[model samples]
Target: MSRRSLLRGFSGLGTAGALAALTGCGVPAAYVEAGDRSAADRSARDKSLVFANWPLYIDTDDKNTSKRPTLDAFSKRSGISVKYTEEINDNDEFFGKISPALMNHQETGRDLIVISDWMAARFVRLGWVQEMDRAKQPNVAKYLDPQLSSPAFDKGRLHSVPWQSGITGIAYNKKRLGREIKHTSELWEPSLKGKVTLLSGLDEAFALLMQGDGVDITRWTADDFHRMCDQVEKYVKNKQIRRFTGNDYIKDLSTGDVLACQAYSGDVIQLQADNPDIEFVVPEEGAELWAESMMIPNLARHKSNAEKLIDYYYEPEVAAELAAWVNYVCPVPAAREVLASSKDKDTAELAEDPLIFPDDAMRKRLAIARDITSGERVEFAKRWNAIVGL
Candidate 1:
């Protein structure tokens, strides 16, 4: 899954309606007052920024435990002290923690955060995050992938910016299967009965399965969703699927407990290094091209500092360095060239990997799944959880 994190649910209700009345729970109006920060207000803020992100996401050195050179360099050059914290473990958990603060119009104590685009869309819709000033992010304005610029959720480059990207595709043990897997339907093949796994998380699992049925992910319908669920029900009854999982699917595939499973492109990159037999396939049906985006929370104290830090990473050379260690899809197209000129052979070779800089062939097979709307979340989560038995 692209780690597209967001929550959705039914609109007309009693509990939800009461909550809605208290905090205007439905999607908030798009940035009318949200984007009105002046240059003076931005400049008068502190030179420090607080960033909240997921764990095990950035590059770290094995030898020197205290130093994050990239971050350190940014601080040195820009005089911005970045207090980076890996406080996000799960989407729903983090939302529960911060929503109360946002509901009361209080600061969430975070200047910036990196979250899956699906979840980012919720913050964008709820007006919990502020619109970024692209003028301060000159490199970002120039280098952000055109494909990610205007998601259906956020119609412009106004609310969020992609931090890194990945694809939701197939990862299988080539040696165990003795054949390459190329399509989503192949997971249900008779020979592979009880040898496959799907993600249990609704936000992470839904779109790729939908695409298996040849559904257009950009505009998938309820009928499309139901059809996929029906197929899953049949698979469950036939015992063709072992079980659903989160990141544990990686361990299952590695230990040979399962021969095949749905996988994130970024995870496959790391797994392939340790076990060369593990192969990632871009299925013929299509895959979700997703990103964990960066956004500024509303009433943040260091908005300008956060914008500057965002642009620093946008520099192609800087982006390439981070991509080399992280191994996710690089959203900056220009970074490919920067990577190609690397002093290290291993780094330069990353420029040639189709997964990182997807070629025309692979690009044609990727789609950004339409985000599940807030009105659809509750019922959808309920049905999806029941299917996965979560």
Candidate 2:
């Protein structure tokens, strides 16, 4: 399955009632204290860890699908057997599955898991994950992209490390549109009415729109959010927006039914492979840079082993290998040089793909938006979801 198909929807935490239950006024007990979050060290004896992640998010052997080259190397090098499961289909579903045990101060039967940063904020707020030891992860400290090191929700990345990074930006069929779209505001051009789509998920859609209005997304106010929503509401009423979508926009754009739409950088990479006319732009106004992050959950028995595995992927060579397959933004900037030096022509060319290793100029336009706070999630999700009719 395509990565877009597995990762696009935000329905896992879509409902206001569910948002309330997870993040609203009551339920102080849902917050785990630091003192109670850790379990006794068993890594020295067990030498194994269970890692759960989204489907198609990792690199695999091209010939024998079962062979994961990098993962196998990690196991061989560290002697830490990994039981990796691609079981986290959605953030909310996975949360629901393991939350019962976590809330009750029990093992989640897994050491580490990956989820989007917005959802990672929820886990960080509730302290459902443990702080990683940077001392044990020197490569992570040395090579992690500076842009991803500090997010509002996890300053200095105390509890999480990005597995892969991507941009949420405007994508258009340059040939079909007969013009380039340089700004988010261009999506609203009269000629483009009924031919443009926006992402339906509230979390996925809002920041890019706010950026178009010249809002500084890192510290945007509720007024900024509401004003952006007001504009979208007007566009929706007038039929300017073809529809709010998930990855389905890929099909629409590909078939020429939709000329341009909000798109994920990774999906656009795959699309451009089949149709180079399709182009993803990090708007002049700016775009939201996001990550699917890895976290070691509270009371995980293999915390030490998990830390080593996280650090291992941070090695530039290993990161380059993964980036070559995934085609998402690599969180380790140094990996670009590694790929550029590859003897394989196609692999060497990936080093120049801005979508994967964003140029310095492009980096200036990318910002990690501030996360929605637990207190604000219910109210904001209610308003945004109402606009998208979710």
In terms of lDDT, which candidate is strongest?
2
Off by over 4 Å in 1: 1-45
Worst 10 residues of 1 by lDDT: 3-12
Task: After the best TM-score superposition of candidate 2, give how far the Cα of residue 267 lies from its true spot, in angstroms.
Answer: 0.6
lDDT of 1: 0.80
Alpha-carbon TM-score of each model against the true structure:
0.91, 0.96
lDDT (10s digit) by residue, model 2, range 157-179? 99999999999999999999999
Report lDDT per candidate. 0.80, 0.90
**lDDT over C-alpha atoms for residue 22 of model 2:** 48
TM-score of 1: 0.91
For residues 103-191, write the lDDT of model 1, one tens digit per residue.
Answer: 55677888889877888888877778888888889999899988888888888769788889999888999999999898998999999
